[model samples]
Target chain A: MLPTLPLGPFIFPTAGLVIIFGAWFCLWVIEKAALRLQLDAQATYTLAVVGLFAGFLGARLAFVALHWPAYQQNLIGILWPLTSGYAPLGGLATGIVAAFFYGRARQLPFAATLDALTPGLILGLMVISLADFLGGPGYGTLTAVPWGLSQYGVRRHPVQLYELLAGALTLLVWWRLVRGRRYDGQLFLTAVAVYSATRLFLDAFRDNTWIITNGYHGWQLVAFAALLLSLLLLARHDGNQ
Target chain B: MLRTRFEWVILIIVATLLGSAWIMMSQEPATAGSSLLTLAEAPIVGHPAPNFTLPGTVGQEVSLHDLAGQPVVLNFWATWCAPCRVEMPAFQQASVQYNGRAAIIGINQGEAAKNVTDFGAEYRITYPLLLDTDQQISRLYEVRGLPTTLFIDADGVVREVVIGAITPAVLQDRIERLLAEAGNP
Candidate 1:
């Protein structure tokens, strides 16, 4: 895995580069998807931008707060970018709240807005999986498959790639079948259901990650549960239509 | 367009079936490649830390297996690595704060014992600084970079790994978590 790259006069973290590209891609998709779904593209783009800034700010502030004792000695150290300490959960919560309020203030239709944001959100998650692949985290278990990538001196499943493929297929389904949906929530629910179902099946390849007691993969169970719920919601929405 | 409920269900089912077939058919468990696969080949969370013995500065011997029944903070560093140097003071402070409750061992990556001892003396570090002359320990632990610290619970299962220079707050936070886990041990 390529962790870092040296491009004359600057060293770039490969994962960081991937994330930047992914964010740009997500925003572009958000704008285009909004237009396609007859929502206000400019407002949706502004909301996304606001959420991005809020996420970064909230993450850094929460990290500094968690490590308050350390920053007490040198207050300026709170702005130290090299620390790279972030509270992702805090950032995510803040981002969602910011986006929700922005959308409400703009009077964007709730379900339609969700439909517009679905692809971009899924793309963001796909980027996370790609980053993990590049940064050498969340690797899969040992495998005897001929297509298995050799890692750590052994053949292993490319779980991250599998996730990427699953995400791409989900997007494809959204483009093909989710267009001209029966209801506003159909786009969102169908995307989540198809994606979560793939996760339920694919997460079996993962080893020693989020696998709670009884040797059950925790993420797979969560995905299965989410898929079932989404399907129920889909059926309900279908009946409403 | 998959408008009907049956269509969406069929679509997802076909996709999963295709994925399952691909994975199953591609795997050749009887191949030589499969033999290389073991239950726990890589250093991962929830797996026991690989045991190793390394020589410490000042004529002392240390082995990870001996540190059982207590939490462990394994810090891999080298004489170089600015980030490693940046976090040494924090590590030194932590070693003192958690003296008996937990153990923080510094494993110098492929450095001479003299260099390690000199660095320790420079920082006035009181804890043991083990020499990984050949970096065998680093490879065993799959340390990707310097200043990588692994917090292992009392049961010797790796709980978390911090890859950059750690601050006092993070160190203390992780140590507290480790200690909490070691309440019985």
Candidate 2:
């Protein structure tokens, strides 16, 4: 179902289109954030360009690492994102880290920039989840729940939609805070905490439950930790003001 | 302390992202496309089969596993897949020829039970029907196009996976090689 990347001998997925949409939307949000914060809009645009490239590279690299054995035999296939795989988390991670380092190299305030970019980041994640649902991968377990999707022939939990809805709600919260809240980075903290908490619960219905501690991953625990730490940072940032 | 805090935050984010990436990567099967021959690697012959399970008309559960310990022939058909209706007689013929040596499992991808059952009855298909209800099995095996056939070995390792429509001769030749490998005396 829209598996490969490209059109004919190649297959470019509608899913990739969604990913670009997410990135562009994030860039637009970043521009807005920069204007509101009185930061240079040029810096935001630079970050977006660099971050997008870095994110693509990072996502591909992460996919290759995870599926090294498969890619090893088919070296040429690695060039195509559809042939290999795509990891949103990996892309986001690499993008943010790259952007941070790039911003630092340019002598920009990394924390302040990150604060402005948070809502956009959340929105990007939500959009990607929606794409995943459309592509028929990254879905959760099967169930008899009324809302369960009848994919193929059996009823399955619409885990992708759950994540999407959760993401939308998180975005709404972030949007509200960014629009009206007095605190800088408050929306960022709320986005992190809300998304992390939703992800933790939604992961239950996911078919690929990476068993770590009590059926969770080390990453989720870290997300929980981030939620706590970010809240504290927001408090401190507010205190400074 | 300030620098340390920043480093910790970055490290945490990187680690989480890596972890999520790993999960997505693991979703693809490792044993895909390791077949020896080039012609065998064609999407029609070498691609992965749509994995599924269905309840036999007799009420006992039959699945891809039920055909294990013998070379298994998996055929995905539907009343709608034009080629599927045409391929039924060929499969029926092969089933009779390969009886007791290897089992033939017909998996219905995206077809309702009533439609599949009626189609099976119309074609006089004697083999067991497996339901890939949610297409979980289909997703697992990477079945893109319809009318797929997978040739699984006695050990449940796929010897060859076929996609698209198949003929009686093609099905029989493949079955003969598998039966020969099993040392059928």
Interface Cα RMSD in Å, per prediction:
7.4, 14.0
Alpha carbon lDDT of each predicted model: 0.79, 0.66
* Candidate 1 Cα outliers beyond 4 Å, as residue runs: A3-13, A63-74, A81-84, A212-216, B1-52, B109-115, B133-145, B152-161, B179-185
Tens-digit lDDT string for candidate 1 (B27-95) = 333442233235353455545678899889988999888999889999999989897887888888888
Q: Report clash pairs, candidate 1.
A: none
- Could you give candidate 2's per-residue lDDT for residues B1-185 as a string of tens digits? 22345664665566456546644543423442232221211122222233345666546687665566688887766677886776677678778877898888787777677777787888888888767667666666666656767787665656555555655545666777787877862
Provide the lDDT at B39 for model 2: 21
- What's the CA error at residue A206 for candidate 1, in Å? 1.8
TM-score of chain A, every prediction, order shown: 0.94, 0.77
Candidate 2 residue pairs in backbone clash: A4-A11, A5-A11, A5-A12, A6-A11, A6-A12, A153-B133, A154-B133, A154-B134, B53-B131, B54-B131
| Index of the highest-TM-score prediction | 1
What lDDT, from 0 to 1, does candidate 1 have? 0.79
Clashes of each: 0, 10
Provide a comma-separated list of chain B TM-scores, one per candidate: 0.77, 0.69
For model 2, the stretches where C-alpha displacement exceeds 4 angstroms are A1-12, A61-82, A85-93, A142-144, A152-154, A179-183, A217-219, A238-241, B1-185
Question: Per-candidate TM vs. native?
Answer: 0.80, 0.54
